[model samples]
Target: MHLMSALLISLLLVSGCKSTTTRTGPIAVGPGVTQSQSPSPEAKRYTYNSDIYLDVAIPVFNPGFPIDDDTGHVDYQELDELDIWPQLRRAEAKRFAVETKQALAKTKAFGSVSVVPNANTSADLYVLGTILHSDSEFIRLEVTVVDSSGEPIDTEDFEHQVSESFFRDAMNQDKDPYEPVFVEVADYVYELLTDMSEQQKQQLKNTTLVRYAHYYAPDAFAGYLSQQLESKRGTQFYKYELNAMPAENDPMLQRIEVLRNQDMLFVDRLQDHFAVFQHTTNGPYRKWQRETLPEAVRAREARSERNTKAVIGALGFIAALALGNNSTSTSTAVAKTAGALGSAWLLKDAYQANENLRVASAVIDEMGQGLDLTLSPQVMEFNEQEVELTGTAAEQYEQWKAHLRKMYQLESSAN
Candidate 1:
């Protein structure tokens, strides 16, 4: 009876019977343990030649205590560094660019990605993203994909949490965390950027906004203006930020600088729009087609320059002849010298005016083409009259006047 009972107990234990007891042991991963290959990633990176972008715009991170602002306090002063916003943006932008390339390369799509400025007026597909909430340790983001005409194509929101200690440790070790952050964030962005739909592409082509900016400064000045774009160190400000400008004693010069900055900003904005436009089949304003205007302007300017030089020479000779002739009356000498000086100044002014006009015309022509605006002098005149005349308009009008002045000079010279 005892043996029978014992056998029955053993059988019950071996028969996979349910038990209220718990068991604990080390989990092992070894050969014969049929280890499962991690599931293939949803986004298989491959090289792609398709136009794609990864633009990153960072908000000012003031280092105030987290309690001061509803979102932890950040020091406002540190944000004021001249290059802070751009530097952050560059870092973020480059990270996205690299990661996008890597992801695309994985799929053998393309090995590289082109990075460009974001413009309001155009982008094949405008990717509306924000550095929603950022702290010293973590950043939260919301990325939305939209067609050029401001319609949502697709949307994605990502929350990235990182350990503050890890970052500090990496910093202490002189290690860069940029790659890690970039890889992660860019992966998220790429997942959205590449998975664009056919409908989105069509919308991008049909609705891309046309935009332009006209900078009427010398090349060197324009270059400087380009470099001084506003970065968010503390507040949003640019190198040429008119608000931070020194109180001016000379209103005219101040006004000129202000105008220059405004124009430069407009240029920057157009550039942003173009960057967005390039991703689409119908790119922002057909820049490739419009590039010919500069050559045309140069050719015309060269001829005007030659004429100006001749007129200047003639005036100089007239002055010299009057000065050398001892028999000439005092009145003759004075009159001749005045006339030469006046003519030389006038010609120089005219040449300068013509150059300005040419630039204005070129800019207008480009804008007209880019925006698909039908441009007739009559139309321009009408537009000029309809709008509230502001400083920029006045400046443009001056350029138009300069063109008229050039025409007058040509007609006068011909006669």
Candidate 2:
């Protein structure tokens, strides 16, 4: 009886004891989640590029329990009563910053980083975060980046709502403690900050030149013309036109000329009817109506001169095509028109300066498929010139009126 009892006890002891020969209990953890602890070089060895200071205002660690006044402050106890999500989120934010710094350090994106409590210590960048919402099953994180001047450079709001089932699965005893939410948030923040920095740097490097005319202020005149053009069409044309401006170091006079010429054409057409009436009543001798010639006329003239110079510039543009000199055609035409017409170039002086048939031929020849920009003296005298007829002036005026009428008829039929 004694031997049997002793044998039973010995058997129980042997079963509980771990064998020296071999034993299979559980898998050993490595440096990952399965491990009890991971090997580290040292916390201080971690590199950081930018200094970041965190300001966490939201209450942390609440499980919705009543305050325990005897233990500590009532507020602290009340906070403890809330759910654990807030505490988890705060922990996650800190972890995120640390991880981000480490990651950036590996890439050598910045110099060094330091995390602090005070936001007023003078840092290159400041990061502020708020826990807008926190529950057992969901959380909303709002983050903002401000420059040294307290100007907000970037902001983002992200909400993570986990299903009840997901929470249950995630909270299982066997599951890892570091939530998937933490990983996701970290990745989101890292990508956003990196991308923003890169974009800002590129923008700084790419300089935009604002070119203006030499005579008049570029901002006001260009702005006026841009408004007109954009009003007629949309922003698309203006964008293209502005993009077409000369680059930095180019001749300012050349740009001014181009702008003036383009604006002049539009102005000339708009004021032609009024100009004609004015000339018939007042004549072109008085500076095309000094009081009110329409503010656009002056501006347009300025723009047109700019354009004319630009077109005739060394870039090699030909204005007239007499077969012999298509290269210098426009300049040659302007000089001849100016010499014959005198000082009336602002209004359709070209039309009055050229002969009727020659004007028609020139318009057809120059524009090719469109109406000729060239004006004849006879046409100008009838259309724009106003005077009491007597000898040469009257005859010239009468001839211009007749030719313009004929051209008008042809124009109507063609249209």
Candidate 3:
């Protein structure tokens, strides 16, 4: 009778224990897909030889939110006060800028393609982008092109969904998940540049060259090539204006070109640091996601199990006490045995839940430390003036432009 009672108690305890089995679904492979068709022979024949220097600025991460009826605006507040999601979104914006630069270079439409920290950097043309949405499944960007004077030349919206094949390719590390979107953006830019008239191309080149001259020797070129005001119709339009042209072979212009190249070299060095920043953050970020996501899910499951076991254990103890007070001695003994076993299992589960919590805390701490180590302030210098490059490129450019205007005013007054 004692042996049977013991066996029954053991069975009850075993039945109460939570299952540890975890089910992971099978991996799904996508069907193969072909690349887009190439351009026609006639289309391929069109090419330009203009020494156009292009600059791509880091995109703004614009999180969408409904403002009013049928209207939406970017939740800049969310990005400014960042959490993990916002941090990831910011990183995606940087990646988009880098990819755009790479794509532009591949097209060979420009003499050189460079990624600048802000729009204030001098170039024949600039590509600015804002990331409307970006995730593992899809990305959307609003891209615009402008000359050195900030005159809008072209604008387009790019939206791409990650197809099954593209996702599979990214999973296999065969290609970047965002490469398709970058390619489309590049193709559009190429088309825009190719479609431009010779007069437009020459005008952009002249604007860029004149801006350089004005930057280095404002006294000599400021009156001839003013970027202050223009008149269109009856209204005065504020823009970069060229009232007179400089000789193509002027010695002063050649000297300015050399100085500009030296500045570009300095900017290139800064870009190298940005590359390091990207590398350090990207690797640790991926590792953190891989380690913590599954652990978080498992932790929740463990807590659920712990709750179940505690409730069952408490019920058993109450029933055992009742039986002991009113039933036969044998029944009382069996009930006590069952209650003790249940209590023991409950204690074990509680310990496991606590352990999971500790592990989760450690993972978070480690991720925080990694982010702290990698994140640093990026400072850029132009004309020996240091400016901390933060916030949107457009914002930075405005600040820089304001500073330039003040300096010019001060110099003009002194003269």
Candidate 4:
């Protein structure tokens, strides 16, 4: 009978060890066994005879923190003015975009991969992405591909959990742990391009050039560059007609080409500013990750310990009740002691979990302050016009495009 009671206690304790706490709120790490490296799928690659320029737009930062149901979209303006945290998030998004561009460029999938400030920038393809969440242990992104006309081509969502081994490799290499995520994104884009029909590829090439010309000299190409739809019984139908293309040697087209080359020079110069921003933020960003990783690990372990103790306490109580009538006074006393000891462990676990969470939060807050020190307004000048390049690449591009339009108009009028 004593042996049976001992076995039962051992079984209960073993079962208790298997259970874990379900984390709630922002403290939750995604469910998975950490992989040393992600599996590489054999991706198909296509070689295009003609050049294809791809523009990667600066990603939007979406803080995945839950808010009240009554609160719709987050007012970023309010947050931007008041919160340093949001500013850090914005910096994270910019860094993410730059890394993605670099990844795409490395793939050699396109003739050129440029990090355009906005969607309005002309390219054969546009990659728009949003940073849903970013932290030391995990990163999530949603990406969409569209043409110059805002027509959706493809969309994909990606999430990656940074394993301890992977993190260590990244630290040793002096690289971002999330670099694999960007590589996957580039692969997805490459796959999409490879699967396109020849006709679709031609359409993409023509549309990109037409849009570039139209932006600078819309009046010259209006009739040749308009979207039209086919109608059946006075209703529009599936059939659509794209703009007609001008001769390759049209004088206005040739002029637009020269103008675009000059515009690209300006765009290339703008990249230096982005390079500076990246250099300024990269150190603090990586330092924050390296410093916070241990805290995250400790917090996870604390939660696990708390859960184990709670389960053991509950099981001990059950065992004590089951053995109450059959057991000797000595056995009863031992069972009671086990239950009491389990309860004490539960209290200790709770305290440790709370302390771990507090420490993790403090570490993140300190990192945010370090990032704030690196923040500064960036401005660039072109043709006597000063443009603020402090916001997302898209915002800065919009300002640059406006300046280009004015310059082009002035030159056209002068001629």
Best by TM-score: 4
Q: Model 2: runs farther than 4 Å from truth? A: 1-113, 162-415
Q: Which stretches of candidate 3 lie over 4 Å from their true place?
A: 1-84, 163-171, 228-238, 248-251, 281-415
Predicted model with the maximum lDDT: 4
Tens-place lDDT per residue, model 4, 272-360, is 65677778888888887777767666656766776777677677667666677567788687877777677667767766776776667
RMSD of each: 32.8, 40.5, 15.4, 12.6
Name the lDDT value of residue 124 in candidate 4: 70
TM-score of model 4 (CA atoms): 0.66
lDDT of each: 0.40, 0.37, 0.62, 0.67
What is the RMSD of candidate 4? 12.6
For model 1, the stretches where C-alpha displacement exceeds 4 angstroms are: 1-44, 47-118, 165-185, 197-203, 209-415
What local lDDT does model 2 show for residue 123? 34
Q: After superposition, how far is residue 39 of candidate 2 from its true place, in Å?
A: 25
User: What lDDT does candidate 3 reach at residue 331?
Assistant: 64
For model 1 the local lDDT of residue 200 reads: 47
* TM-score of each predicted structure versus truth: 0.28, 0.24, 0.53, 0.66
What is candidate 1's lDDT per residue for 99-166, written digit by digit as tens? 33343334432222323333222234443445443322334545554433333445555564444344
Residue lDDT tens for model 3, 1-415: 9999999999888877745555586545567744444432332233655564444444333333323443465455653332224455555656567778778777777766666556656777777888775534446888877666656666789887654444233343434556678888888887878777777777777777787778767877887676666544443535786676788787667666766665666456556655676566766655554445455455556668777777776777777777777877886788777887777778677778767756654554455342421324446554577776444444544454555555545655675
Error of 2 at 67 (Å): 18
